[model samples]
Target: MTVVVNHHGVSAADVLTVARESATVSLSVDAIAAMTKSRSIVDSIERDGRPVYGISTGFGALANTFISPERRAELQHALIRSHAAGIGAPMPREVVRAMILLRIRSLALAHSGVRHIIVQALVDLLNHDITPWVPEHGSLGASGDLAPLAHCALVLMGEGWVLGKDGHRINGGDALMAAGLTPIELSSKEGLALINGTDGMLGMLILANDDLAHLCTMADVTAALSIEAMLGTDRPFHPSIHAIRPHPGQGLSAANIFRLLQNSAIMDSHRDDFEHAVQDAYSMRCAPQVAGAARDTLDFARGVAARELVSVADNPVVLPDGRVESTGNFHGAPLGFAADFLAIAACEIGSISERRVDRLLDVTRSRSLPPFLTPDAGVNSGLMIAQYTAAGIVAENRRLASPASVDTIPTSGMQEDHVSMGWAAAVKLRRVLDNLTSLLAVELLAAVRGLQLRAPLQPSPAGRIATEFVSLFAGRPGPDVFLAPILEHARATISGRDLRQALEAEVGPLA
Candidate 1:
């Protein structure tokens, strides 16, 4: 798919396509016209010789200093070079790609006063698969991810490094040359325009939002399976029970669980049995409440990402009314708060999932299923350690849940104080999501085995389908034989979209 960049109307879905799917992008004709108009305004201002924040003067703490016309080009170069002081390992290729795409989106708005050719250079790099080597550290998430973005801008000047299609590192100048592209010379405020934006943290936010939405659905699927495996009733998921609360996410999660348990033989087998407990544990019965809250939090985060998609996050924005003004749109507070909130939500989901796994593994609590879901309880360890793994990941997620947005440090000689630390929040949120995937995989593994141990008492149609699909990778449940490979395969299946897509095909769509 080819995404057309314009002054407005870009969506998070569009960013995902270009960032993760390697979709090429082009500037719209309207975007070009806007760029020309904004560029002329920049030129007129420069001609009047008034000191602008980034055009005729230095940046950050040096904003008060003025430069000669002949030295302005050097000033731009120095800004990129000095700010390229990020210290850490290179960021992932997908992250770099998303940052580049988003930066293009910001510049395409024509508010940053850069020439259309500079935006085209970025697009060319993306189309040619030339990814800049942005480091993992150095972004304060204030003033628009300066250090990391500088590395990206350095590549435009053919002065940094890039990763080739084959994943090998190549010199930036050589990479551009091989792609039949020319290196751009930074002019006036062009360098600042290239780096000053919330693209880095915003890119991660968009990607994480996509992943968490899918995982939220998966949480519903796994929770339903666990309920059936433990002989729990689905009555709590009744529509009437949730209608009183009326939280949108709670109702959605309850509906998903209720629908998944439809025609469930396992649930039906004990529906009238006198020995069955009147109420199931919170993990099984209250699954919707916990998972529902996570969904609500994700919905909030999604709104933040949507708003940022069209916002211009630059210091000195060029207005359509021919006036240049400084703005705080570059601050990362919104992105930071969203990322941190998502992390907290993810932790709760994982926490509830781990509890379900614990229930499935406990013989005393597993409702007569063999200890740890194994036939020979004493002879085989069974899934005893799988619960341990889930617990470990859940603990790690709790730690990763610490909000990075609340922490701050002054920088640039105290000229820039109270940073957002949003980049750190995004990075840790990624870790939290990954940990959630692994723990959920553990829950899925345990739930499927518990369902199999239920024997002739079959699961719901949806559970059976999920069981059949997982069996392909998890192999038949049995004695503890080489478990790592099986667990890893289960993780891969859960983490990717395959399991959810496969389930949706049979059960219709999950919320």
Candidate 2:
């Protein structure tokens, strides 16, 4: 499927389909026309000898200087070459694709005053799968992710490195030539128009936002399985309790849990049984509160990202009346704060998941289950080491959750002072995602094991489906058998398949 880029309106789902599902991309002809008209205005202004920042004049820190018309092309080339100072590991191919799409979207807004040829060059690269090698580091997130985006601009001029369709690194010039493409000579403000934006930060947020949304749904499913495995009371998920406060996420989560556990023979068998009291521990009882808070965090981040995706993060925008005006749409504080919030939300999911895993392993807390859910206590370690591993990740997630937005260091001679370390924040969120995936896998494994012990007493339809899905990958644990396969199976079960979709197909849509 061809994913269309509409500058004014792009959805998170579009990003996921293109980035993950290998969807083709195309830009609208109307968008190109709009950009060309804007560039014509900029050209008319320059022909009449009007001073425009970075177009007729110079860039930041050099804004006081003026360039002669004869050196305009040289100035544009020099800006791209000078800013192509990005270092460190190459960013993922998906992120590079996202950056390309976002940059094109921003230019499509007709505010950046870039030539049509430059926009076409970007679209050609996307269509031909020529992904530029952008470095992960070097963006302070202020003044529009200048350093990293410079690498993208360099590729348009055929001056950087790019991965070809065959996945081999080659000079951008050679790649463009091999694909029957010609290098674009940036004109006037074209170079600045390409690189001067928050596309880098916005691209990262788009990917992270999509991942976090899926993770939120998975968290609710895992929590439901854990609650049933513990035979916990369903009173915590009662509608009356959540109706008083009515936080959308909390109420939605409660409704989901209640639906998942409905018509369970195990719950019916234990409805009148006096195991302890009316409630389970906070980890089991307050699952909605912990997971719902993460849901709310995702909602907030989505709002910020939606606004940023449609914004023009360029400088020296061209007006309809043939005038140039410098502005500050390139600041990344909004994206920075949103990425930090996503990091915190993911960390909480890991934190609460680890605790639930701990409860499943504790002999006293787990009731009839053996210590660490092992068939034999002293002979085999069972899931004892798995809990330790989950705990270690939980601790690391807490450390990764530290807000990268709060800290900043002066760069570009302090002219670009007060940066938003949004790159760091986005990278940390990716780490949290990896850790949470593994942590939840461990919980699912333990929950399945505990559910096996309670067999003959049937689980809810949702829990039954989860049990069968997990059992397909993991088998019943036996004494003196190596558990490496079980752990691997559990990891594959959670990470390799879309658990939420599978459950939704069986139980209908979740709240």
- Among these predictions, the greatest TM-score belongs to 1
Question: Once model 1 is optimally superposed onto the true structure by TM-score, how far is the C-alpha of residue 24 displaced, in angstroms?
Answer: 0.6
Q: What is the C-alpha lDDT profile of model 2 across 387-413, one tens digit per residue?
A: 998999999999989899999998766
The clash numbers for all candidates, in the given order, read 0, 0
Q: Write down the lDDT that model 2 would get.
A: 0.81
The stretch of ten residues in a row with the least summed lDDT in candidate 2 is: 6-15
Kindly list the per-residue Cα lDDT of model 1 for residues 255-323, writing each as its tens digit.
Answer: 999999888889898999766648888999889999899899999999999999889898899998988
Winning model by lDDT: 1
Off by over 4 Å in 2: 6-9, 164-168, 480-489, 496-498
TM-score of 1: 0.98
Candidate 1, overall lDDT? Answer: 0.90
Global lDDT of each candidate: 0.90, 0.81
Candidate 2 residue 258 C-alpha distance from true site, Å: 1.4
Give TM per candidate. Answer: 0.98, 0.95
